[model samples]
Target chain A: MRVALCGNPNVGKTTLFNRLTRSSAPVGNWHGVTVDVIEKRITGTDVILADLPGCYSLTARSKEERITRDGVLFGGYDVVLFVAEVNNLRRNLYLLTQVLEARKKAVLIVNMLDEARGKVDLELLSTRLKIPVVGTSERAKNPKESVLEAISKANAPSLPYLNEVAADAVARRAAEKNISPEFAALKLEERDAFIADILQSESSQRGCYGCRGCDRDRPSALRYSYIDKTLDGVVSCRRRYALTDKIDKIVLGKAALPIFFLIMTAVFFVTFETAKPLSSLLGRLVSLAAEPVKNADMPEWLCGFLGDGVIGGAGAVLAFLPQVTLLFMLTMLLQDSGYMSRVAFVSDGFFKKFGLSGRAAFSLILGLGCSATAVLSTRGIAQKTARCRTAVVTPFVPCSARLGVFTAITAYFGLPAITVAALYALGFVAALGALKIMRLFRASEGEDALLMEMPPYRVPSLKRTFKAVFANVCSFAVRVGSVVLGVGAAMWLLSNFSVRYGFTGGSGSSIMSTFAGALAPIFKPLGFGDWRAVTALISGVAAKETLISVISSLGGAGEVFGSAIAAASFLIFSCLYVPCVATIAALAKETGWRYAAVSAAAHTVTAYAASLIFYQSARLAQIDMKLFVVIWSSVVFAAVAAAVAHKIYRVKKRKGGAHDSAARKERK
Target chain B: MNLSDYSLKRGVIVSVGCDDDTHRRLVDMGLIGADFYIKSRRGGAALIDYGDFSAVTRNALAREITVRER
Candidate 1:
């Protein structure tokens, strides 16, 4: 039997799904984490469980919402497990009522029972709603027994409620108007085309005509009236209870914010500083493993390629994998505990003023971990224009790859670690400022309701946290494995090949030098217009982390610290420059090439302009600005100019609206 | 008028339709509650105020919901 778990967003539906199926999918308190549908089988039963996207009602408002709607109505699941928040029974019933209306075999799983505080009258609710109710707390309780019991009791066929008179009237209308009862009802209710089409098709097949004897136009009004009357007796809620408010007071009251900050700071501190020893240990193990290969009677070329080029380049990235994994785990823990949603809510006021939704805050936070994934995460934002704008600015949010660059640069400049951290903060501030400027010209015409749920605060589970972290890290490793391999080999070839001289004695005379020199002038103002910096930026195209490998290959890892401040400036420029190719491609797929091109150009110019200003200002202040500053500043200046140009283009296009309207009309 | 302007508190079913942009989104998401409940409210960033228990920012919430205060 196929079972589908369905619920509104942030109801711990995914958490319960993970618990029941023992699957390791990432769960977030924020909405739209599970954008696509996932299916898995129960171990003992012939049951396949489908986890549908969290939606308010099955009415499709976005692509994710439509996925849930179609999954429920047409996906042919044998049983629908309706997950709801126990504390918010009245609102949860909105979707539950839809499930009943669909006539789908279903059972109610009231999750977060631990947080419910016995406020819900489950027996009364079950009897009134005419469905079996099972209470569960995803954190503290094992929902296995309750879930199994509900499934065993799911023998009855699904029968959704309709207002009695309205159902009869729809039936009569279907006969008279040649529409099916369902179709007629949906049409009368003025539901979306998908629902209307479903009903209409059913009625047409049944040989129903048009609305002849029935009042077809007034069906929705009559049906709602009928529903309102039924709700008078069946549904009741207490005004004074304020369960969520009380919970919030206990969890996120004024003190909760500080506690949250402490936890987040602790996560960053532990992941970055404490993980160093573990990461070094892992690096040593990898090096030791490679020693035997080096000692083997392999060709000199093979040894050098495997030991230095392949393993070295890849190991340089892999050494940080432990830290990345730890970071992901901590992020998932915060998310699972539901504090992340509160963070978004608390920060929404600040972010929205910059023409971004609170959701963008989540993406920017994720960007600090990995910009590519952060770009993908923007799928959760409902408004297309806002999502694009967020994508445009995301690269500025210093990702993990850039973090390595920062460390290398700090060592090069002999600056304090706090200075490196301050640079990161500077990048964040710059990103927000850029977003505000981008918003002025590219204001999102689309309106997105920023509805999110504050999932009841609970201590995160080690099992779930590890699972989520592992999944994210594994995906990142796979991506890095492929991209880094290709980039490593290419860099090796570029460093060895000299067109006229054949194999170059050193990297300076190799093909990479030629290419870097050709592009050096573009970044001259930022003080890093040399071949080494240029080559690093080029390799960064493959994956941002590849910059570390390129830099090491060109100037050795020791040079990272000697040029510390300039290197730091370079890192900042690299962070804000064009996103890796994969992100550009993804943006192209989501929006269009035009937008993607614009995004790339804007980032490159912004990085150039920002670096230029930073270098110039530092130099004038008598700060020991290094050679890398010139190149960095030039790139930053270009980025600013491109952003300004793009803004102007958008404004002009908006003012040229008649042409746009004509084009839209033509498309229609 | 903004949703904040209304006296409607929790548990009240408000009648509100999405403006042009939100309308397209609601139509896409299959959100049926042109009329629905005010699930919860806090002084800071209204949480899960309407439409299938989804959390919405107060700014967006201000534009999307209009309460029928009793």
Candidate 2:
């Protein structure tokens, strides 16, 4: 059986699909999460279930809607499972009405049944609509037997009200194309651009081919009226302020921006702070695992290969699993709860100023976790320009891979964790700055206005949330095992063998060192030009964690830096240098290699320039302790002064408004 | 009144003069003949709730929509 899940945006279609298929298709509590056709087998049954992107109707107003229309029309399906939130019964029926007219069989699963108990008359609905209606709390509900039974016994329901002219036009088109009459009729009635083009090609004549459809704007209203009439018989919703509305009164107010920042800061704190001890513990465990392998009386090369080449390389990457999991889970939680939309919705104003849209916020936040995945998420963005801008900036944000490098290097220098936080902050600042610089040469175009849905905040499903987080963790582990381990093994072998094919184990006289030494002079101007620092950066392009291991193997970073200025400059270079091949491939997949190549080149050039400035500035201004403390105090005082002045200005403005109103009253 | 005039207020859409593509999308997205409420307004975009549907629309697009007091 080929079962397909279909619904309006944010209506738990993907949630139920995830549960039924045991697949993680990135169900966020936002609009347009699923943009492509996602199909998987329904276990224990000979069934293939597909999830289509959400659309309000059978119309193609956006990219996702187009995908949905094509999928449902062309992808032959045995059954359509029309998933909808019960509280949204009226809106749900609009699509249901259209689908049942064309589709063979469907089970109406009223998700969020907990909220629609007495208000929904299911039996009356089942009778009126002439279909099996199953109520489910999709937030946390098991598959009911009725859903399966309904799928097994597939039958088309009675067709609802259809305009005579529209039906005839649709039937004629269906006869010509030999497609489903109901689906084709509705698509033609709705004036679907794709269907019109298809019919246009079949009929070379310019005259009207089939039935004369209603006015362009009439079909949608007609559908809404049909839905309203259908609901008048079986559904009743009491007008009440929902919990989401009450919460929105505060969350959507002026304090929303600060609240957003606070949430992000807390996430950062939890990820980095909690991952510290856990990372150390993992590193210790890896060392313990390696001890026996090292002492196993095997040949020296074999032990070295097993110990450092495989175990050590994989271990270095795995040690940061804590941070990776934390970041991934937190991002998923935000996405699931629907705050991610609000964050995007609110940020549109600020982003518009930088030639980006509010939708870019989703990709940027995901970038903090992993640039490769972040680039993939940009598919959710609507506009082409916005998507491109988002993909280009994604690599500039420090990803989980680079985060581990930053943490490891910070610990090496005994720098405060705050130093790492500052670098992360710098990444965002640089991203926005890069947007401004990049936009200068291109023809100026206004940013797309935000047209996003703000889904009601719901408690994220723990099962699905953990499922997504675990899937991400597994992917990261697999990458470490394959890509990072391979790169590490190659680096280890190159360092151990000389160009003359002699094994000089400890000395920096091997092919790797020789290759790195030649490149060292190129970076000498930035202060940290040592062969070790330069070599680590070259390896970083393969895998970021490889840089950490490479630095360790090529005599420690401190041994290369020799001063705070050089160390800071090298860290900055590391922060902004070329993203790993995985991220580049992801970017290429999303846009094209032309964009991917530009991103790689931009990062490399920007990294060099930024590092030069940092190195030269630090060298020019010797910061004594007294001068540092004085500068920090002055900045703190200025911030406090600005806040007080803003408060006073607000107070005066309110008073003046009151006085002006009183004067108007006196004149009256 | 037009949609932009009903800031932070709830009303029912009377009619939408969709002279352009954006307003056409609004009507097609089920924004017409429904109770419309604004949650917030920022950067020329109004966050609104049309019945069970929620969306953010640019103020320019909102001007094309007409609404009546509920």
Candidate 3:
């Protein structure tokens, strides 16, 4: 038997799914995590459980909506589990009504019963809706039992409830307008054209009839009346208890924001502080494991290859796992508490001035974890231009992989930790500026508004948090291990091989060196124009983290950070350069290779330009004055210039377009 | 009156004009009823102060919804 879990966004559908299937799907605080359907087979039964995207309705405005609609209509699931939040039954039922209309067999799983605290009249709700409703919670001690019971009893048939007046109105409108009842109702409700077309076709086939005043003429009015009548009989709530407001007050009140900051700061402190020892420990283990092999009278080539190429490359990636895992856990917790959504809510206005939607803000937040995954996460956005623009700007957010690179370089340069923070901030500012500029020129098509829900706060489940952190760590390990290993081996071979001259013995003698040398002159104006810097740039294409590996292999981390200013310049360049191969692939997958190429070209040019400015300014300043003052001046200048230029360009272009159109009309 | 004219500080009841799509959506969501309250405003998004469950909506959408301060 096939079972599909469906619900409005953030109705605890995923938590319930995880509980039922014992799966570790990332349960996000907001909507859109499960945009694509995920299928997991139940252990004991022949039942296959499909987790469909959470959607507010089946109206299908966004990709998530479309996916859910298609899944329900054609995906051939045996049972549909309609999950709803106990506190928001009315809003939840809006989508439930649509599912019922689809004539699919369904079971209502009213989750978050802990939040309900026995206040919810489940029996009344079930009687009124004429469907069996089961209350469950992720926090429940025996959630598995409740879920298993619900699944066992899922053989019950569907009971659709549509108010008599609304049903009559739909029928009347369908007949009067010669449209299908569904289409006529949707049209009255001001639904999208897709629904209109469906109704129009049906209406046209069924001949139109005249009515003095058909109920269909006022579909919205009829719908409201039907909903009101239904609620009057079935739904009830205490006037004093507002679930969302009460939860928000406890979780995100004025005091909560500061606490959140403190918690995040602690997380960062622990991650960075603990990573050094962990990295050292792992490094020692790797070297120790290789010692016997090194001592063995193996082939010289084989010893060097295994010892340096494989072991060294893998070590570089694995050393950072501690920090990455910590960061993921913290982010997951913030997400679970619903604080991240609040951050998006607060940051929306700030990001909007740059022409980015609120959803892009969420992707930026995710970008801090890993740019490739962050780029993948952009699929949640519906607008093509916004998604593409987000893809282009994501790399500038500086992922944890880049963080590892930054830490290594900073340690080498003897640069203060604050400089690292400053560099990250610089990247963020640059990305925001670029996003604004891109949006101004591109001018997003259609009216794309951001509508999001602020889910009631709940303590994050440890099992789920651990699962998310582990999944992220595993994926990162796989990526860095395979890609970095290949690049490392290739680099070693290239450096060791000689065609016309004696083996150069290092990257300096390799083919990459020849290319880097060729490109070195082009980047001389940007400062740090040595072959090593150029090679780092090239290696960065494979993966941003590989730049650090190349640097480490060439002359250790200490040599790369010889000077604070140069190190700063290097960090800036790395942060802004072409996104890693994975991100480019993701961009290609999302918006075609043409767009990917364009994005790469745009980012490379921007990075080069910014690095040139930074290096030149530093040279003029002579690194004598306070580093903070110099950094601040440059940042402020860039921010102002970017903001002004973006606004003026957009305004001028719009006026010019309008004027030209007017002139052409007059001439005509 | 224009939406900009009313001093609807988020948690106030407001009337809506017919042509605003945002207002229409709010009305559909049951935010435009006479007794609904505006809860809070942060970063241009307002939460409707529903007695039992609040609805958060964008300020641009809110402006389309005319409200009388209670």
Candidate 3 segments exceeding 4 Å error: A141-192, A199-267, A287-295, A379-384, A444-450, A499-508, A514-517, A524-536, A559-564, A623-668, B1-28, B32-35, B51-55, B68-70
Best by DockQ: 2
Worst 10 residues of 1 chain B by lDDT: B24-33
What C-alpha lDDT values do all the predictions have? 0.66, 0.75, 0.67
Candidate 3 per-residue C-alpha lDDT over A1-668 given as tens digits, one digit per residue, 9 for 90 to 100: 88888998888777777766777776788766676788987666577888988876665656666788778866788778899887676667766666665566677888877777336667776666666678777777646555556666654333332333244545664566443355345444443345545445443422123221233224344444544555664545444444556766654455655765676567667777767788768767876766666566877656666665567656665666777787788888888877777776655666667766667878888888878777877777767787888888888888888887777677556677677677677878988888877876877664345345566666787877888788788778877777777776676566555566645556466676776778888877766777767776777788776776666555555564456676777788888888888888988987789988988887888888888888877876775557757777888999999989999999999999999999999999
Q: What CAPRI grade goes to candidate 1? A: acceptable
lDDT, residue A567, candidate 3: 70
Q: Reference contacts recovered by each candidate, as fractions?
A: 0.29, 0.45, 0.20
Chain A structural similarity (TM-score) per candidate? 0.77, 0.85, 0.81
Find the candidate with the highest TM-score and give its number. Answer: 2
Q: Which ten residues in a row are the worst by lDDT in model 3 chain B?
A: B17-26
Error of 3 at A657 (Å): 16
Q: Report how far off residue A430 is in candidate 3 (Å).
A: 1.1
